[model samples]
Target: MRDQEPAPVERATRRLSTKETAELLGVKPETVYAYVSRGQLSSRRGQGGRGSTFDAAEVEALARRNRRESTPGSSPDELSVRTRITLIDEDRYYFRGVDATQLAARHTYEEVAEWLWTGTLRPGARFTAPKESLAAARRAVSALPEHSSPVDRLRVAAVAAATADPLRYDLSEQSVLGAARALIPTLATAPPLLRATYTDGAPIARRLWGRLSHKEPDEASLRVLDMALALLVDHDLAASTLAVRVASSARAHTYAAVSAGLGVLEGPLHGAASGLAHRMLVDVLDRGSAGLVVADELRAGRRVPGLGHRLYKGEDPRAQALFAALEELPAAHAALAAARDVVATTARHTDLHANVDLALAVLTTSHGMPAEAGETIFAVARTAGWIAHALEEYGERPLRMRPTGHYVGVRPPQPLPTQTGRE
Candidate 1:
C-alpha cells in the first residue's frame, strides 16, 4: 500500500551494512541490488581497506518511494502490474491456504512439484507418466563419469535433458513453468549409485538414449528431497536471483537467465552450505559423540555452517517441512539417528534449530543419497525461480546504478616534472 506521506526523514546518522539495507527494503539483498541497478539508491565505498556500505537515509528514501507506489488507494504501477512470471514469490506459497509442512506430509514429490508449478493440489495434476520420465533420466545419468561425483553427473544430465525443451523460448509463463515442473524431478533424483561398482569392480551398460531410469528410487527419500526442493524453490531476491535479473535485464533468453542463476548458485553463500552441514553431521557421527568434538569446535570459536539463516531470526519455516519429510523415510542411517540425539541434547543453545540445509542433510543421508548430490539438487530446483525472476526484471524500466564515495587514495599533488638529481 502507498504511504499517504513520507515518514519524517531522519538525518544520515550511520553507515548501514548491505544486509541492513536489505532488511530496510523488506526484500533480500538481491532486490535491493535491483534497486541499485535502477539508480534508485546510492552505495558508499569506504576509503579504507574495508568494503563499501550504503547510506541508510538514501536507501530509506528509495524504500519510501516504493511504499508510496504500493499504497492501497493508488493505482498499481505498471512495473508492479506486469504479467510476467513470479519465480521467487508465489501466492503466500500456501496451496489452498495449507502450509507446506502439512502438504509434504501426505503428498509425493511429483504432487508437490506439480502443485508448486501449477497451483493445483490434486494428485492428478502430477506427472501423468512418471515412469517414462524416470527411465529417460536414468539413461541420462550414464553420460556422467562414474568415478566422478554422482552430484556432478546429475547436474550435467539435468542440463542436457533440459536442452530438448523447444518451448523454453516461449515468453508465456504457463508454458515455461510447465517445462520446469517436468524437469525438476528428473533432475532432482540422481540414478541409484552403481551397486557393483562400489561393492566390487563392475561396468555400466551402454548409454540408453532417453531410456527411462526406473530404478525405483526410495519413495520416501525422493519425497524428502522433493519437499526440500519445493520449500526452497523460491525465496525473495537471493544472490542467484540477482544474477538472473541482471542477465534478463540484458534481454537474455530464458535459458540464459536460468544459466546465470545456476552459476551464482554454485557459490557458497547461495547453496554449498547445505552439503557442508551434512558433512559436519557425518563428522560428529564418525567421532561417536557430539560432546567433546562439538565442544572443541566451539572452544576454537568455530561457527558451524548451515545452522541458521541470515534473514530468519526464527527457525526457517522450510526446515519444518523438511524435518517432517525426513521422519517419513522408512529407513535412516544409524549415524543420522545419533546426530538427531546430539542435536536434542543441546536444545538450550546449540539446538538453535535446523534450516533447510540441515533438514536436507538429514533427508539425503537417511535415504542413502550421495553427499555430493545436495548442492546440485538445490541448483536444479531453484532454476525455475531464477527464470521467473529474470522475466520479471526484464519488464522493469531501466535505471542506472551509481556507486558514490569511491575514493582512491590520499590527496597528493602530482609530482611536478620531478627532476630527481638536479632538483
Candidate 2:
C-alpha cells in the first residue's frame, strides 16, 4: 500500500479565565472554584501560572448541564410563592441568611425555631406544651388505631389541640407564635412514650427522645437529635410546606395549617422515606453485606431509599451534618458503617449520594428507635417551618394561592352522560 500522508495537526483548544468561566456558567467566581474542587470541571495554571484557567469546551458543557438540571419541565406559570425564610442554593441551604448547619451545630432546636419565627435568636428558648392542649392531644392520639403511623397520630393530635385552644383562629403574629410554641411541644409529647418518664420542662429533643427510644440517650446522642431537629426545621417550600402555605392563604389557623402539612408529610416520598431506609439498613445488617441487600432492592425494581436528593447535587448537607454528629457516638458505629457500605455498593451502579434519610435511619436503627421514629422527628421539627410559612402566607391577600384551572378537560360543553347504573 502507498504510504499515507501525515495528518495535519489540530489547533489547541481555547482556555478561558476564571471570570469568563463564571460568566459562561451564570454562577459566581467562587462557584467556579467550587466546581473545580468537586471535580465537575478541571482547571490549570494560567499563562504565567499566576491564576487558574478552564477549558472553554468543558466550561460550556458544564453550563449546558447546569441549565438542563435547573430548568424544570413545568409551565412558566407554576406556583411561585414569595418568602424570606429558607433559601436553597446548590448543595448548601440557609435559614434567614444564616448557615443552617452552623445554627444546628451551635444552637438548640428551640433557639433555631425561635430564630426562624422571629429574626431574633433567643438563647435557651424553651417551648412548653400547655397542660390542656397536651392532655387533649394525648387523648386524641391515644384513640387512634394501634398501628397508626406517627404522622397519623400527629395529625389527630393537631386537630384535637386546635379544638382545645379558643385562640386558634387568631392569626396575629404574636398569637401565632404563642400557638406555635405550644403546639410543637404538644406534638412532641403526644405519642405514647416508651418509658413513663416526664420531661415536662426539658428541651423538645429530650422530651421526644423518651417517646422514640426505650434506651436512655447519652449526651452525644441527645445532641445529635437536637441538631437533627434544628437542621430539619426548614428547607424552602417543600411539598408539605406549600400545603401549609395554601391552607394559610385561606386563613387556616396555626394548628390547622400545621395539620395540613402533616397530612402531606405522610406520603411515601416525603416523611416515610426514613422509615423505609431504617428497614433497609436492618435488612442489610441481618444479611451481613450491603451488596446483597442492594441487589435485592434493584432486582425488585426499587430505587435504593435514602440516596440522592433533587435539591442537592452532592451529598445532602443535612446528611453530612448528621453523619458527622453520628460519628461521635460509639453506639452508632455499626449502623453508620452499614450505611457507608450501602453507599459504596450502590455506587457501582449509579452516582447517587447519601441523603438525610439514610443518616436518620442510622440514628433510629442504632438507638433502638422504631422505624417510624424518623417520621415523628420530621413532623415535630418541620412544624416550626410550617408555622413560619403559615405566618408569612397569612400576611398575603386571601386565596392568592388559588390557581386558575387550564380547562384541559371537555370544555364544559359535553351533554350530561346517561345514567349507566346497572352495567
Candidate 3:
C-alpha cells in the first residue's frame, strides 16, 4: 500500500486559536466549526487536546476551496501521523496490522512484544531478568517511602535498571530491545508489593499474578492476564508513547526514553484511566444500585468514567472481547452484573459505550485484586510499546517532535506603566 500523504502544511495561519480563527473569519466561534465540518476549512488538534487550530491560509481561500464541493462521504479531517506500529479504526485496534483481539487469544505477551519490536512473530521469545538487574531494582524500590504507590516503585526500578546496565548507551535496534527485555521484567518484579518467591523461567503472566494477588490465580485467570498484557502492548501514538518518541528523537538511551514515557503515563488523563474506572465500579457495588449511581453521577455533571472513549464510534472491541471472556468465569459474576448495568444505563442517556479501561477495571476487581492493580498491568504492558516507539523514532530526524509555541505572553522589553520598577 502507498504511504499516506502528508497533512496539509502547518502554516502559521493554521496555528490560530479558536478565538483568533473566529475573528479572522468574521463569524461566531460556533460557526467556525460549521465551516470545518463542511470541509471549507481544515484544522488539527492542538497540543494536550485543548482545542483545534485552523489553517490561516486555508481560511483565506475558503471561498475558492468550497467552490469544488466535496463528495457526500469524503474522509473526515484528520492529522496524518506516520507509523508502522498500531492502527485504530472503526472501533477496532490492530498491532502491526494484526487484529489485537485475535492475536491476544493464542499469543503470549512475550511473543507479542517480540513482534512489536522486530516486526516478526517469534512465539517462544524469552524476556528474562538478570539476577544482578533484579537486585538493583529491589534496592531502588526499597529506597522509596513505604507509602509509595506501586507505580512509583516502578519508576525507581526503571532508573536502577538503566544505571546498572553499562551497555545501555547503545541505540541500535538489538541493543534497545535487549535493554527493554531486562527492564520490563525488573519493573514488574521489583515492586515490593509484587515481590515474591517464584521459580525461575516462569511465564511473565504467572509470575506477575503471584505479585498482584496473595492467592494463586487459576489457570484460566492466568490466561486472561496473558491476553490483557498482549492486547495492551501498543496503541498508536498515545500521549505517553509520544513522550517516549520525543525522548528517543533527542538521542536519549532506552532507559531514559522509557522513564519519560512512565512519567507521562502516571497522569490522571493517561495510565490512571483504569484506576478511575475501578472506582466507578466500586461505587456501583457498594451502593447496590448501578442505575442510581449512574444517574447521580450524571446529575452532578460528572462524566461516568470508562463509559466512553474519543477513539471508538461504537463499543471498544477490546472491551467487547474482554467482557465475553468474563462471561465464562464464575468469579466475575457480581462485578460483571454491575458493569453491564452501567453500560446499559449509560447507553440510554448518552452515546457513550464501554471502553478498555472499564474492561480492565472489571477484570481486576472481579478477580479479588486491589483497585490499583490494573494500572500496574497497564504500565508493564505499555513498556514494550514504549520501547517499540522509541526504536521507530530513532530512525527519524532528531528533535522533530519539538514544537514551537505561539508566544501569547507579554512582549519583551516593555516598560512598566505604573513606574513601580516591576519588569
lDDT of candidate model 1 versus the reference: 0.56
| lDDT by residue (tens digit), candidate 2, 323-376 | 999999999999999999999998987899999999999999999999999999
Candidate with the greatest lDDT versus the true structure: 2
**Candidates arranged by lDDT, highest first:** 2, 3, 1
Name the TM-score of candidate 3.
Answer: 0.78
TM-score, model 1 to reference: 0.59
What's the CA error at residue 97 for candidate 2, in Å? 0.3
Best-to-worst TM-score order: 2, 3, 1
TM-score winner among the candidates? 2
CA lDDT, candidate 3, residue 150: 70
RMSD, candidate 2, Å: 15.2
